[model samples]
Target: MKNLKLLKWILILAALGLFAILAARAYLAHRAAPLGPWHTHVPNELTAAELARSDWTGYLEVESAIFTELEMAVTRQLDPADRVPANRYFDGSPLYPGRFAQDWNRSFVLDPDGPPVGAVVLLHGLTDSPYSLRNIARRYREHGYVAVAIRLPGHGTVPGGLTVVDWEDWTAATQLAVREARRRAGPGTPLHLVGYSQGGALAMKYALDAIDDPDLPQAERIVLISPMIGITAFARFAGLLGLPAIFPAFANAAWIGVLPEFNPFKYNSFPVNAARQSSLLSRLLQRRLARAAQDGRLDALPPILTFQSIVDFTVSTRAIVDSLYARLPANGSELVLFDLNRSVKFGPLLHFGGDLDPARLLPAAPRAYRTTLVTNAEADRREVVARVIPAGETTERIDRLGLQYPSTVFSLSHVALPFPSNDPLYGLEPDEAEDFGIRLGALSLRGERGALIVGADMLIRMSSNPFFPYLLDRIEEGIDSSASGRSGIDRDRL
Candidate 1:
């Protein structure tokens, strides 16, 4: 009798809990903002067949049509108050005053002055345009390599496109980019794939796919910046957040974040579907990586160079080591970690736990890959140095660098890896020569909380890398090695 009563109560509580959750979701959905022109203008999901039929030009044509529709809808539906002042969405607003126009959001190819000795495909992060990789692409071009930066579908336009696109669409776009790179480089030339954040996962996936499929072009080297090897598990259930969207009354539930679209190159708003698709992609990549590792096929993967911050809010830094690097063979793979700035005066306020140590994550001795940590030489000093531990060695070697961590910065962020210190938009010391309407990184905002359109946290996060020179030097070293027919880094050069 007692057991039966307990079981009955348990069932009743579970039912009540579920009912309460549904009620809360419905209430929140009803309070959401009304669907705007951007929401109504969702682009058709790109099919694999359609992507197959289209070349880069055809792809751009489809993209232009979508952008045209978005523009028309914005003009007809959006009120002036809904948009930023002097925005392209406004009537009689001058376009491309200083920064790039909306059309610059499309894919771009940069050719070297002479015949390309090598080629590189640069992939930007989710919600980011090809412009994110423009500086890096130019660098590769100057080094006598053809650089192609592809604008992934559902990006570089209105945020609504991300609401309807699937993860497969992104993978398909990656395939197209790789194909174009191979075609331009021709046979026997070194082909490199460089990915940032979400693009990092795509690059890894493509490399794995190439290993399994003989028809696909193999990458000579892979470079990743703040790679999304793993994301939060909450992303798996992100679709549930948009459950209210099923009802027309709660259409705004589809968006996780709806903010003023001030930044021209990146989307300020984010949809629930974007989170779901990224989660799905990361999960798929992990599964594929594990399968390859188990099957011994990952041994065929090319040399990998990854730059990641020790403290990243977006992706798992631990996963990068445990999931990806740990499984790799004794190939010439290198993991560069940007450590926190111990020079900050807030030592007493800061928590110094074992979790802050990078040594804990790496293996004991005779490691399969090289690990380089860029950190402050001392807790009290701003001077920085590179502490390197070569593959298959337990000893450490320190090399003093001319660079020092910025006084204001306590740590490098995931988004800060690829951008330089003097970027007009996101740099610590913004370039005054070029203006993007606003210098986001240079803003030292101070006011009451919630006074600004964007959150204080968003503005506070470091957006540009201070150590980009070191990053560039490392990439140039890799290029030199490829040109010299060497597979591994020359330790003596360091």
Candidate 2:
């Protein structure tokens, strides 16, 4: 009778614990910012079948319809005072002034002056519009390559669009972009795929898909910037956090972060479902990569060039090394790692001792792929050097670069790898000639907390690369070598 009484007490405690957790979640939901029109009114999710049937024109039509609906929803929901300056949906706002009149958020195609000799399809990252890759696309255009930068579905419209879309929809959109690129370049032209962040995963997956399907257009070369090969394990269970969203009382539980829409090109507000979708995509890609490696199908993959930071807060650098690069079949793949700034002033504070050295991640000798490290020449100087290790070789060649690490900057972030040093929005030294209303990178905000719309973390994150010139030079070198009937860096050198 005593044991039975103890069991009853345990059951009571367990029920109370569950109740307390639910009550806390409900309270937090109630305290959250009220759902805006973009959050409450979900957009149509694109399916693979629909994307396959639609051409670029049909795709644009569907996008226009969604944007129109979003505009109407915003009109009905927000007051005139709340709508004008802060909301991007409204015209004549400082965030999106009527300088262009037409929306610059959509996908764009840039053609060369002459007939295209090569074709390049550029895919932007998650929560980013095609504007992110405009610089690279222009470079490709100047080189006589037809560049197609597609604004992935669920993006460039509203943040709510991402809440409904899945990774399959993203891959389907990639297919459409490739088809358009193929048509523009015609046959016998070198086709390349360039992807940033999440788009990098799509590009890698598409390459894998091409290996299985003979009809798909094969990419001759692949470029990835801060690829999302793996993300945090928390993202795997992010969907569970949104379970309360099923009840209208706790609808705010669906959002991971709700912030003001300040950036014209990217979404500041992030939803829990978006994180879940990205995690699903990364998991699927990892599985496919592993299966392909085991079946020897990865041997058919084209040359891949990747640029990544030694320390990335979003994705795992170790995963990129162990999962992708380690499995590659020496098909002229190269990984360029930007090491942390080990300046003399910050040397003591920096963790230099431990296993933080990225070079240690590689095998003892004769690595299958080439590795390049952009790092400081010594412990005391700000000058940077390029340490290149040729494929299947142990010897390292150190070359001094004219470039010097900026004293103000300590390290590059994942988002910094793509944009140049002179970008109007994110550059450290923003171009004054071009104005994006707000020069985010140049802001030296010094005020009490809560005064800003966005958190301090958003401003603290590094957004532009100082060594972007070297990155562009390396890319152009590869392009020039390819045009001369050679594959990437001379195999003889390797």
Best by lDDT: 2
Which candidate number maximizes TM-score?
1
Instruction: Give residue 428's error in model 2 in angstroms.
Output: 0.7
lDDT of 1: 0.81
In candidate 1, how many Å is residue 467 off? 0.7
Q: Which lDDT tens digits does candidate 2 get at residues 1-494? A: 99999999999998898667666766788788787776666767468789977777777788778767766676456766657666665666667623444455787889999999888999999888887788888888889999988889888878888888888899999999988898898877778899999999999999999888877888888899899999989899788777777889898888888887878788888988999999999999999999999998898888899999987888888789888998999888899999989879677777653235875755565888899999999989999999999899989999888998888788999898888888988898999887767777777778999997778989878889999988888777666655655353222211
Q: Which window of ten consecutive residues has the lowest lDDT sum in model 1?
A: 485-494
lDDT of 1 by residue, 277-323 (tens): 99999999999999999999888888899999988888988889988
Alpha-carbon lDDT, every model: 0.81, 0.83
In angstroms, the error of model 1 at 344 is: 4.9
Q: State the TM-score for model 2.
A: 0.92
Question: C-alpha displacement of 436 in model 1, angstroms?
Answer: 1.5
